[model samples]
Target: MTNYNELTVPEATLIQKQLRDNIKVTPYNGPLNYIAGADISFNKFSTTVYAGIVVLEFPSLKPVGYSLVKKEVLFPYVPGFLAFREVPALMDAWTQLPVKPDILVVDGHGIAHPRRMGIATHFGVLTQQPTIGSAKKKLFGNYEEPGPEKGNYSPLTDRQGELLGYALRSKNKVKPIFVSPGHLVDVPGSLDILLRCIKGYRLPEPTRLAHNAVNQFRLNEISEGWTSLL
Candidate 1:
């Protein structure tokens, strides 16, 4: 495992470059038994981080299991280096999963980043798993606002005119969500899966469930652990 906190910005940037080569941007064609969402939460200026991963049954989107980890994160919340602060705890939760999901939906950017190494992309590379980034705001790239209808999307492109992801309206009249491929998946493929995971909300089921779960866990004062709902 990488010493996430011990590295300087330059070292982290280099690591990102090396890991970029490991990313295989292909269409998602794996098993559909399960899909997971990961999220991290903490109070303002607090080092106590709460990380959660919620696994749902494919197609049904029903929760089957979850893992939680609370740790003191020393890394500051840098806009681009969020994975350095969160992935360590997220991976701790990942290891405790009795059964791993076929894909992960992370609440951050993916390849749609300045260095092509967003939290989703970073985590996917570490685990060698297919992951998608479902962010609520734009981090990198430009696109026209999508139509104010469910499932409408506009192409997101970089300055070089290279396709990055899509700005999708998951629900009618709601703000668009940025969908991007993290690793082992392409731009369209990422959006395709996110469309299926939507449940009439701004955020998709997998990530929404996680976002809610982690916040609740923190509120309830839960500790680091894993639970099986299967």
Candidate 2:
């Protein structure tokens, strides 16, 4: 595993460039028994990070289990290198998970980055999991606004017109969510899984549940370990 800490921005950029060759893009067509979402939370003035991964049953989207971790991060906040600051805590939480999910929905970008190395891709490379980025904000791609209805989407491409991901309008009247393939998955697979997880909310059930879980873990001072909801 690469060292999570003790790296300059230039060194991080170099690493990103190297990891691009290792990212595999294949459409996932197997039956999904479970799916999960990963999220991280922290204050602007603190190095402490709260990471959580929530697992839900496929189709039903019922909460089955979750893993949470609170740790003091060592790396400084950087624009594109956020994985260094938050992935370590998430890895810790992953270790505590009872069962692994079929695919992970990350609260950040995947290949939709300047060097095609976003947090989701970084984590997927380390853990070798199928991950999809479901970000609230766009980082490095241009796309037309999706139609003002559920399930409408538009292609997100780079300056050279290379396909990266999609801008999906998850809910009516709300801003679209950016979806990108991380690893072991293709653009169609990423969007298909996310579209199935939507439940009348802007964010999908997996990520929305994960975002809520981490915030509760931080605010309510919940324990940092596996908490099965089953």
lDDT of each: 0.90, 0.90
Superposed model 2: Cα runs more than 4 Å off: none
Tens digits of lDDT, candidate 1, 10-80: 88889888888888789988888899999998999888988999999989999998899888788777788
Stretches of candidate 1 off by over 4 Å are 221-223
Task: Provide the global lDDT of candidate 1 against the true structure.
Answer: 0.90
lDDT of 2: 0.90
Q: Candidate 1, residue 198: CA error in Å?
A: 0.4
Tens-place lDDT digits, model 2, residues 1-230: 56667888889889888888889879887779899999998877887889999999998999998999889887897878878787888898888888899999999999998988899998898899999999999999899999998999999999999899999999999999999999899988899888999999999999999999999998976777898876
Clashing residue pairs in candidate 2 are none
**TM, every model:** 0.96, 0.96
Q: How close is candidate 1 to the true structure, as a TM-score?
A: 0.96
Error of 2 at 135 (Å): 0.3
